[model samples]
Target: MNNKLKLSNEHTLARVLEIKHYTKALFSFKTTRPNNFKFKPGEFVMIGLIIKGEFIFRAYSICSSTWDNVLEFYSIKVPNGPFTSFLQKITTDSSIIIKTKSTGTLVLNALTLGKRLFLLCTGTGIAPFISIISEPGTYIKYNEVILVLTCRYSQELQYFNYKVKQMLKQPYIKLYARNKLRLYLSTTKGSYPYSGRITWLIKSGMLIADLKAYNFNRMDKFMICGSQQMILDVVNLLRSIGYLEGAINNPQDFVYERAFVS
Candidate 1:
């Protein structure tokens, strides 16, 4: 093993605390965070492992809340993927590499004050929103927080449903957000409580009706994370209704980040 190809040990060794396989293709894992590791709830950081003296890494959203003791991540195991292939084989106490810096456009700071915050996501894109909804800022900033998740199968929704139910049981979360938080789990290829693309549901006005939300007022803000296609389609949908893109420096109506680069 060449020392030149090895990762540095200064601020980035994350020991795996636990791993949960949600499905054949999806999983979630928690790791020991460095005492100095700091990040907003909805940001992403480079997570990796040293393989045969080579450092291989990818950007992963932190699925755990900032207040949580350990860092958590939700991921998709691409069968032959260079990174995930090795990642999925890890067991308890395995050491993983994490880059010190974390950043993303999905944080609540990227959007201005609003009465309602809509988190639109698909598949693993739901990772960041999980952190967002778990944070105290989400409940304080908006009267309501809506999580809209669309996947191809109903079973894929299990992880989120379980987490939400667990969060609901937390005394503080339930007290502040029991009625304010909402989850809309939908599937496109499987029979579920809600079926069809979120774009269509938004266009058909069924989403608002289901929530019985006040008319899409100017105070509504949106944060979108998903495939490029899903993000683009939803952008068009929001724009058609007078929404605008936002950023940290110039917070506007909505913000978005690509779920995966490929």
Candidate 2:
């Protein structure tokens, strides 16, 4: 199946906006979007850069909230590789090409509504969480939001921690009595404020306590993103606990996507 389609200029553009450095190799950007363009959060887009008359493209998830006019993405610099090598040097307001028609299954619409929302991710996988966490509607739609992020070390968790701290200062958002958003983090290779992989935490029921969650049930929704292994791990674990998969056509207790192939 030729699922790939060449987009028209209407859906593609070279706009420059903001650039940010998260770690030594990971960075993010915000680009201007066409006035008429709109998309759900967590959808991946074909982003590319023009170099030497060639367009080098890669799949990147949109990390910005849908209400925002501009699109956002979190990226990793591929050493001496196609787009990232040059992308890392891009300053704020630098131009880069983007394709139209973003698509992916990670959007919140794909999952079944539940009493609690579990977002499990690792590394850049936290990209989509940025969008989900920022939306006040996300909190309104679910009773509670619990995010579990894993990285090689605590430093990688800094980007997410900073954003949540900012959200905490929002008076209106914090006003939602039971609509609290919690962050659970683990660092596999290095010591962190929190200890292990999400799978381990869930299996041992440690994450449930850490989030102060009651219990896993069909009344809960789970969004899993990370390495294939992590997704499978969480999926099977959830299934054992009675959670199921979901889609727009047939919403289930859970939905999934790769954060960025780990």
Ten residues in a row with the worst lDDT in model 2?
Answer: 1-10
Compared with the true structure, all predictions reach lDDT values of 0.85, 0.77
lDDT of 2 by residue, 1-262 (tens): 1235444574566576888797997887888886677677677778876666666788787787777777878877878987789888887657666766777788788887777888899888887878888787788888788888998877777777876776567666567523477777889887677888888998888888876668677678888877778888888888887777788788888888754445
Task: Write down the RMSD of all candidates, one decimal each.
Answer: 1.8, 4.2
User: Which portions of model 1 show Cα errors greater than 4 Å?
Assistant: 9-11, 258-262
Q: What is the clash count for each candidate, in the order shown?
A: 0, 1
In candidate 1, the residue pairs with backbone N, CA or C atoms under 3 Å apart (3 or more residues apart, or in different chains) clash, namely: none
Model 1 clashes, total count: 0
lDDT of 1 by residue, 96-124 (tens): 88988888877788788999999999999
TM-scores across all candidates?
A: 0.94, 0.87
The TM-score between candidate 2 and the true structure equals: 0.87
Lowest summed lDDT over 10 consecutive residues: which window, candidate 1?
1-10
